[model samples]
Target: MIVRHDAGRRPGYPAAAAVFAVGMAGTTLPTPLYGLYRQELGFSELMVTVVFAVYAVGVITVLLLAGNYSDRVGRRPVLLTGLAFSAVSAVCFLAEGGLPLLFAGRLLSGFSAGLFSGAATAAVLELAPAERKTRAGFAAAAANMGGLGCGPLLAGILAQYAPRPLSLPFLVHLALLVVACVLVLLLPETVEDPERWPRLSPQGVVVPSEARAVFVPSALAAFAGFSLLGLFTAVAPAFVSGPLGVTNLAVSGAAVFSVFLGSTAGQSLTERLGARRALPCGCFVLVAGLAMVGASLAVELLPLLVAGAVCGGLGQGLAFRAALTSVAAAAPAEHRGGTISTFFVVAYTGISLPVVGVGALTVALGLRGAGLTFTACVAVVAACTGTYLLRRPLPERNRE
Candidate 1:
């Protein structure tokens, strides 16, 4: 187990960020490959959504049950366990023969991500030197978006150019998972107590009383932002390959990557705007992105689709980070993990539920029609949230 010293210079923050990046990248490795699975497995769009929802269920379960495990047992143990789940997930994919295996693979992948989300973020922040806290936040956010973006791009390239398209990508990711596990071993642990291990029990979702007002708006913004991310991650590849006449896995992955790239760019601007202003602005930007996405579907324009990805991703990044920062600032230190987990539970629901609805809609309507429908719904939600945030003022100090 890696042990972090409270006094001595911490291990390199960027290094910790890199570890986080690789872990997150592994979580999204399946994004670009969904089309391949659909074709090979002969599953419908609805089935794909079901598979995706299964992953979300796994994520929610872990977050609800083990969200604060890292805090009690230390970051390294939880992170290592998460990576182990990733390894198992890759193995499931590699051995996949039917729908059950696919479900298992996604479920394991979700479990891995659920554990990593909180543990890795906390680890990255704590590993940073005292003066670089802000940079540390950026590092954490970048690693998340950058790594998620990289997953599809890497898988797409390997699956397109490399032999054994479906099998090879998972195998390559398994190797990367091994490397990440070793890196986690080398990293210093941030939690102070090693001996005081608590028996595992569910940590009920906790939100600070003071943060309640900010929580509603902030969580709503998060729901909208994550809903956008869910679209690309869960369904965009099928849309690209089906209606847009883009079949190459690499190209499909690049489309997904564009959104995440936009998110990273959007996050960089958060420092200049402050959290309150950024939250509403992000919602507006997301609506604009959704509009572009709708236009792309109407015209079958690939460039427009790419533009939508970037815009939507940027909007998600801006709103999500601001929401997280605000919620963290408002939450009491003692219940921080539970509060953050609760936040993510809501965010993941956004990621899972709306996309599932789109999948169901795709079964009746065609992909384009479903795309337009999703765009309209999300646009309405984002517009309303943006208006609410803009009309109200932020509390000067957290009530709690």
Candidate 2:
């Protein structure tokens, strides 16, 4: 949310956002094809989440280590580096030696995403003309979530309807990455006189005393909300194919995409609701979505599962945006960027760790049982936070 201004900046946020979207799309390209991998490579359910979790680990590691790298150097170099990682990730999927290649590919993909997350957003925001700043912000958000949502859908359609299920999805993505790299080449550098190769400085987590009250609940809400995303990308396809009786890969991909679409819709409401109110409101909606997910698992109903994806995604997006805004406002301006970086560490942790737990549960409880348990626990966390927030909402007094 903190954007630096330089004189004579170009007006190309739309192009920057397009670059962001293309880069992110590669991150989730493997979602719908997990089942095919399991059938061909013979890995367990737990392995699926582990593969997904590796990407999160990569992202978190990069965020902690070089999260401010673009600020020190420049956005273009970081973006190009991200695209390069993305291309390699696609290549790993294409080679498909075995599970090892899949994990390596996912880790590389995570590295690309980690680089893209901070740098691309800054690029989009900094590229905007003063008059279009607000719209640019929305464009950045849309590209992030919308691109993530599209990955699964695009993969599903290609894998199901087109040739070479595994190879084709990534092949198409590689082509798109080429386009993104070209776009990045065209974008003007936003950082004024940025170093070509600055020394890397890790930005450790920081939660100022004034922001703790706001940060704790906001982080918890994000943790609970992102669990659904982990569930969908890592585990939902198997659920759809097995219990829900839907074998169409496109449908499976669409199911995953639905949540992200809902997330995008949810984010659109944040400005209207105000960040302070949107956080708790999002938590309540998320809890309701979790309930539906649990019910879908219990009854084996496809419609309810789809419904849960939408509602839960909506809640996640709404709470996440508000959480970032509220915490940044509470922090001192000097520490604001570090504070936001810390927040993303927690959010990505939510998306990664709990998913592994669900995969572990699958061995003992079966997919449906594990999903039901996951939903119940997350719902309780969200509900408690929502109730607490209702009594004591995030304070706007500290907001700048």
Candidate 3:
């Protein structure tokens, strides 16, 4: 196998990062538009979470079955296919008139995200100079969250001010996907002499025993952090419109965008703090953010809610990036893709399962009350993780 080591050749990392961001951006373009869908389809709040969870379902399924495919098949082919999934998802949303299309679109988006999570990340890292690996990690994390952040921001701006809120965003996304496809085609393949493609089958969770200790705490932190994201992506808009009386789609989109922006900021902190210190510190911040969220729910305050989203998002970003970088660094090159996929499996589970719980609780507690309950639960989990990390921090090398 002849892996490219001449990072100086053309520095294709930027192009890879751009493709990563574009693919990821499409998955989240629907975040701020869920409310409009609810209105058009006349679905209950519970159904909204259900629609969102369906996407998570698709992501988790792909991670389990095909998460490591790129490791064997080469990065370019998997990325092209993932981009295709994203474009099809955009088309689904563009043609959406009811719940079925919503679910289908979300599922396809989830698949795209699952494929991107491991492949795009590996590609970006591989394309970077060894000396620039840290920077590459930042770029990858930023593209993931930054792309996600831009999604709502783009959709909200277009939806609030432009015509055909639903149709326009997807159309824009489809165009971006086309651009991403072109970029992928132009980039060199990272994996050299990859194994021949085999019949597809589930690549069940496989964590090396040596890495389990590090993986457990890292995965826990991710789970807690992602739960906050789930709350925002899946439910916060309803909270904004229903209780806070913010009907503007742009405002709601901005609110979601704030958390992701905070996350991007938080990821930048990881290099300075080291992954170990960053993890606990992030957990503490996450707890505080969740507290603010609960307070906002109680008092029905918009600023407090936004503050919570930002703080919690920053915290989530910090811990999540640290967790991902540390875990990816620890894995053997041969197993890197599968290990990263496993980490995402745990993280996405946090995003899906807890949000579904919140949705179910909404049936009885209403949105605000259920949101409060979620905030409390996640805060407690984060606090415990933080406390544990503080006492028994990962080794300094692992922390790197």
Best by the lDDT measure: 2
Residue 46's lDDT in candidate 1: 84
Model 3 Cα lDDT, one tens digit per residue, 28-124:
8898898898888888888888888988989999999997788778899999989999988888888875888889999999999999988899899
Model 1 off-target regions past 4 Å?
1-11, 398-400
TM-score of 1: 0.95
Each candidate structure's TM-score, on Cα atoms with residue i matched to residue i, is: 0.95, 0.97, 0.94
- Give per-residue lDDT, candidate 3, residue 361: 94
Q: Which number leads on TM-score?
A: 2
By summed lDDT, the worst window of 10 consecutive residues in model 1 runs over 1-10
Per-residue error (Å), model 1, residue 22:
1.3
**lDDT-best of 1 and 3:** 3
Ranking by lDDT: 2, 3, 1
Worst 10 residues of 2 by lDDT: 1-10
Model 3, backbone clash pairs (residues 3+ apart or across chains), number: 0
lDDT of 2 by residue, 288-345 (tens): 8999888988899999999999999999888988888888888888888788888989
